[model samples]
Target: MTRSSNAPLSVVLAGGGSAGHVSPLLAIAHAIKATVPEAAIVAVGTKDGLETRLVPAAGFELAFIDRIPFPRRPSLDLLKLPMRMSRAIATAKSILRDANADVLVGVGGYVCTPMYLAAKSLGVPIVIHEANTKAGLANKVGARYTTFVGTAFAATQIRHAHLVGMPMRKAVATLDRAAERAAARERLGLDADRPTLIVTGGSLGALRINKAVAASLEALAAAGIQTLHITGKGKAVETASGELLTAPLYQQREYVDGMEDVYAAADLLLCRSGAGTVSEVAAVGLPAVFVPLPIGNGEQARNAAELVAAGAALLVDDASLDAAWIAENVIPLCKDDLRLATMGESAKHLGIRDAAESMAAMVLAASGK
Candidate 1:
C-alpha cells in the first residue's frame, strides 16, 4: 500500500444499496473523523443506491461507480457480467487512485464487490465489516483479501472476523430511556404513566406487520397498553374514532425524524429483525418481539438469534404474527413489568456501545495510520 508523506490518513469507504449497508459505512466514517480530526473520508457507491442522498447529506464526498450486480443465476445477463464488472472496477480504481486513499473499507453491498477487487488490484489495504450473522456475498468475497474484518454479530464466521458490533449512531448508542422518558413521551404525544408499545415495519412498511398489528390494536388497547405505530410511507391504518382517538392511546405516525424520542418513550418494541434494527434495539436496551422477514436468505432470523438466546428478544414467524399471537403473547408480556425490565437489561448486556470507535481503530491499524 502507498502512503503519502505529510498528508493525513485517507480512507475510501465503499458500500450502499440499502440503509443496512450505508448506515454502518457512515457511522464508521464519522468515527474515523472523530478519532483523527484531519482524516479525509470519501464514500464510494453506485448512482442508484441510497448512498446517492445519504452520503452527501452526511457531509461526505461521494464517488460513484457503475452498478453491476453479480450474476446469481445463468441468464443473458450472465453473458454480459464480465464487461460490466470490468467497467465498475475501473471506475472504482480511478476513484481510489484520485483520492490517494491509504486504505479501503468495505461494508457488504453490490458496490463493494467491485470496490474490493479494485482496491486489491492497487495493493491498498482492505478492511471489511460484515453486518449480518449470515454474511452477505460482497463481504464474504472481500474477507478473502484482508485480515482486518469486523462483524456485527458474534456468530458471523468470516476468515478473520472480529466482533466489533454494529456501528450505531450516537443517538442510539448512548440513549438512556429512563433519563429521557418524560420529555420523550411528551414530544411523541404518548401517555407518560402507561406502558407503550412501539410497532414498526421499518421505513417501507411490512404488509404482514401492518395488517396483524392493526387487527390486534383493540386487544392491546384493552390491556391498558398504548401503541405508537410507525406505519411507514403510504401505509394507512384504520383505528376506531371514539375512545382510542380521544384517549389517543393508539398513535400512528408515518415517520419520525427524531427516532431518539421514540426509543426513549417505548417500553416494548414490535418490529422486523433486520441487522440494523436488531442492533439498534439491543443497543438501546429495548425488549422486542422480532418478526423476521420471510425473504432474503433468512439473515434477519439469524441476526436476532443471539438476542433471543440472551433473553433480550422473542422471535415470531411472519405467518404467526397475527392478532391472536399478539393477544396471547404480547399483551401479557407488556403488562409484566418484571419480565420486560429483565429482558431490557439482557439486551443492554449483549450490545456494544463503543463499536464505532472499535471499527475506527481497526481501520487505523490496517492503514498503519
Candidate 2:
C-alpha cells in the first residue's frame, strides 16, 4: 500500500447506486491525486453495486455502509429509513475518524446522505457533485449543508450550483480519435472502409434500446452499415442473429471495456441520454440518436432535449421507438456523411473536458489546502 506524508490532507468520497454517480467520483479522485500528490483519498459506499469492485480496482480504500435506496413510495422501508440513516451516520463517523479525513465529498446517492450529515456534525467541509439536469432527492437534502455544489448540467436546482459538467476518466476523455478508431476496428476485426454504428444502453443496458435495434437489424444491414453492439447482460448478439452477415459486418458483446475504441470506430451512436453518456458523446464529438429512459418525471427526456436543441444529437421518445422509426430516422444519419459530420462537430463543442480539475480545485480551496 502507498502511504502519504504524516499530517497529509485527507478526503472521503461518498456515493454509489449506479455507474453514473461512481464514475464521476472516480474521475475526481484521479484528479485530486494528480493535482495534490500528497493527499490521502478514500471512498465510502454500500457493499452492493459496482463500487464494491470498482473502488478497489482504482487503488483506493473503500469503507462500506448500510444500503439505503430512496423510498419511491411510503412502506416498511420508509418507516425504517430514520433508523437506517442513524446507523449509517454512526458508521460514517467511525470511518471518518479512522481515515482522519479533513473534508467529505458527496457524489449524490442515499449513501451520501449519512456521510454528509456526519461531516456536518464533525464540522468538516462538505461538497456535492450533481450529475442530473434536475437535482436528485439525496443531493437536494445534502445541499443545505454543503459548502460547494457542482453539476454536469448548467442550470440545476442546487442553490450554489456551478456548471462544472461531468468528469470522465482520463483515459476515455483524452483518447486520440484517429489512433483509437484504427486500433479499435483492428481489435474487433471490422472493416475500415464501411460506416459503422455503435449502440449501447449504458452499463446495465436498456431493454427498450436493445429490442428496437434488434428489430431493425435487417434494415440497417441492407443500407450497407456495419454495427458494433454492446448488449449489456440481458441479450446476446448470437441469439439475435441467425447466420447471415456474420463476418466483417457485425460485432456484439455484453460490454465493451474499450469505450475509446467504440467511440473512435463508430460513424454514429444510438444510446440512452444519461448525464455520463451525454458528456462522453459530447467530449468525443459523435453524432447520436438518443432514446431517453422513460422513468420518474421524464428527466432523461429533458436531458436529451437539451442536446437536441444544441444540435448535438437527435431525440426519439421511448414510446415511439419501433423498428420502422429506427430504420427511417437513424439509418439515414449514418448514411449521410455531411449531416453526420455537422452533428459530430456540434457535439464536440459542448464538452467541458476540464471539469474534473475545476471540481478538484474547489475541493482543495474548501479544505484550506
Candidate 3:
C-alpha cells in the first residue's frame, strides 16, 4: 500500500445494497473517526442504495461504484455479471487510487466484491466484517484475501473470524433507559404508565411485520397495551394510523429521529432479527419477539435463534404471524412485569456493547493506524 506524508490514515469502506449493510458500515466509520480523530474514511457504494443519502448525511464522503446486484434466479442480470463485476472493479480501483486509501474494509454486499478485488490487486490489507450468522457471498469471497474477518455471530463460517458482535451507532451505545423511556413517551405523546410495545422492521421497514402488527392493533389496544410502530418509508402510514385511530391507545410513525428513545420507551419489541437489530435490542436490554425475514440466506433466522436459545427473545415464524397467534401467545408477556424484566436482563447478557471499539481497533490494526 502506498501512503503519502501529508494524507491522513485513509480507509475505503465498501458495501451497501441495503440498510442491513450500510448501517454497520456507518457505525464502524463513526467509531474509527472517534478513536482515531485524524483518520480519513470514504465509503464505496452504488448511487442506488440508501448509502448515497446516509453516508453524506453521516458527514462522510461516498465514492460511487457501478451497480452489481447479487444474482438470484437465472436471468439477464446473471448473464451480465462478468461485465458488471469488471466495471465495478475498475471503479473501485480508481476510487482507491484517488483517495489514497491505506486499507480496505468490506461490509458484505454484492457491490463489495469488486471493491475487495480491486483492493487486493493494490496489495492493500483487507478486512471483512460480516454482520450475519452466515457469511454473505461478497464476504465469503473477500475473506480469502483478507487478513482479519469479524462477525456479529461467533458461528459465522468465515475463517479467522472474530466474534466481535455487530457495531451499533453511537446513539444506540449511549442510550439511558430511564431517561429514554420518559423522553420517548413524552415525545410520542404516549402514556408513561401504560405498557408499550415498539415494532419495527429495520430502516426500510418490513411489510410482513407491519401487516401483522397493524392487524393486531385492536387486540393490543384492548389488552391495555400502547403501541409505537415504525413503518418503513413509502408505506402508507396514514392507512395504518387510521386503523390504530379506531383503537384507544395506538401510535403509528413512519420514522423516529431518535431511536434510542423508542427503545427506552418500549416495554417490549416486535421486529425482524437483522444482525444490527439484534445487537441493538440486546445492547438496550429489551425483550423482543423476532420474526426472521423468510428470504435471504436465513441469517436472520440464525440471529433470532441465538437470542431465543439464550432466553433473551422469542422467535415467531412469519407464516404464523396472524393477529390471533400474536394475541394468544405473545400479548400476555406484555402484562408480566417479572417476565419482561427477566427477559431484558437476559438480553443484556447477550450484548457486546464494546463491539464498535473492537471493530475500530481491528480496522486500526489492519490499516496500521
Using lDDT as the measure, the top candidate is 1
TM-score of 1: 0.95
lDDT for model 1 comes to 0.88
Model 1 misplaced stretches (Cα beyond 4 Å): 1-7, 238-248
Candidate 1, which ten residues in sequence have the lowest lDDT sum? 239-248
lDDT of 1 by residue, 1-369 (tens): 233455589999999988888999999999999999888888998889889999999999998887777778999999999999999889889989988998999998888889999999999999999999988888888999999999998999888989999997888888998999999999998888998999898878888998888787778888899999898887757545522222247878878877778879988999999899999888889999999999988989999999999999899999988999999999999989999999999999998888889999999999986
**Candidate 3 lDDT (Cα, whole model)?**
0.84
The lowest-lDDT stretch of 10 consecutive residues in candidate 2 is 239-248
* Candidate 2 Cα misplacement greater than 4 A, ranges: 1-7, 237-248
TM-score of each: 0.95, 0.94, 0.93
Could you give the candidate ranking by TM-score, starting with the highest?
1, 2, 3
lDDT of 3 by residue, 1-369 (tens): 333456568888998978888988998898888887878788988889999999999998888888787678999999998998888888888888887888898898877889889988998889888998888888988999976898988778887888998888887877767667887789878898998888887777888887887789888888999888888676644463364233568777778887788888899989998888888999889999999889876878998787799888999888888798789867899999999999999988888787778888898898876
Clash pairs for candidate 3: none
lDDT of 2 by residue, 251-302 (tens): 6788888677888888898998998988888888888899888887777877
lDDT of each: 0.88, 0.83, 0.84
Q: Which is the better candidate, 1 or 2, if ranked by TM-score?
A: 1
Lowest summed-lDDT stretch of 10 residues in model 3? 237-246
